[model samples]
Target: MRTKLATAVGAAALIVVGIGGAQQASAAPKAAPQAGLSGSKTWGNTVGWATCSGTGTFRVKAICKWEGDKHTSWVTLRGGSAKLVPPACRFKIERIGVHQSV
Candidate 1:
């Protein structure tokens, strides 16, 4: 009886240790993707473009619209500019917005 009880207790203790190790492993910080320039704009005579330019830690969003088609783009930047241009369509700058990323 004593040996059986000890065996059960040992198994339970091992399970607790395993759970703790798993929690610690999951809690470890994960590497984030490098923040950089992404996506591009289409160019044309009728295709209008809107640029959101700024410096410092922030996000910039630009919305452009044509007769019925619309395009939107955004970027998170430490310091740079992001442009949104409609593809093969006459678009006007609907709006440009900026907000702090942090």
Candidate 2:
């Protein structure tokens, strides 16, 4: 009777609320970007060595290519130089990218 009908209505309301909560979570904005390197490069030769130097509140990433292999290394620069020696297969620096923090 009335009690059963009320219980059913309460359950349906809870279900709707739950669905609304899930939708809000799914619609949430993406994460903000942090200080890091952004960009790319294409070296024509084996990039066995690479370095990054700068003066700022940013991060540097050196992308290197060795023979037919490629790798990436990262470094945070406050006001100096940062060097990156990729894995054993990397031979030269093909590209360098920087990202500054807000």
Candidate 3:
């Protein structure tokens, strides 16, 4: 009887620990950086390319929107220019936005 009680208590404790771990993971922020979009432009046809520029001391976040899809990511700028490569070919770039966090 005592052994069964101990086993049940241990199992309950493990369940609580597992739930805590899951909650922590869900609370963690996404890998994407938080920033603001300043300006951006796209070029090319077959293999499209893009450049995003912004004013911020930290890294910049670029959100690219295509036909019916959207991609959010971070880019490091050199000389105020950050290059972006689309995920697919012939995907019309509808909009590109930049973000910077303070």
lDDT of each model, Cα atoms only? 0.48, 0.49, 0.48
Residue-pair clashes, model 2: 5
Cand. 3 Cα-lDDT: 0.48
List candidate 2 stretches off by more than 4 Å: 33-102
Q: Residue 45 deviation, candidate 2, in Å? A: 51
Q: How would you encode candidate 3's per-residue C-alpha lDDT over 11-83 as one tens digit per residue?
A: 9999999999889756634332235334444534434445545533333222334544334464555446566
- Write candidate 2's Cα lDDT for 1-102 as tens digits: 999999999999999999998898566333112333222332344444344455434433445554543434334565556554444435665654443444
Winning model by TM-score = 3
Clashes of 3: 7
List of clashing residue pairs for candidate 1: none
Candidate 3 regions exceeding 4 Å error are: 33-102
RMSD of 2: 13.6
Residue-pair clashes per candidate: 0, 5, 7
RMSD (Å) per prediction: 16.4, 13.6, 10.0
Spell out the clash pairs found in candidate 2: 47-91, 47-92, 47-93, 48-91, 48-92
Model 1 residue runs over 4 Å out of place are 36-102
Error of 3 at 44 (Å): 31
Cα lDDT over the full model 1? 0.48
Between prediction 2 and prediction 3, the one with superior lDDT is 2
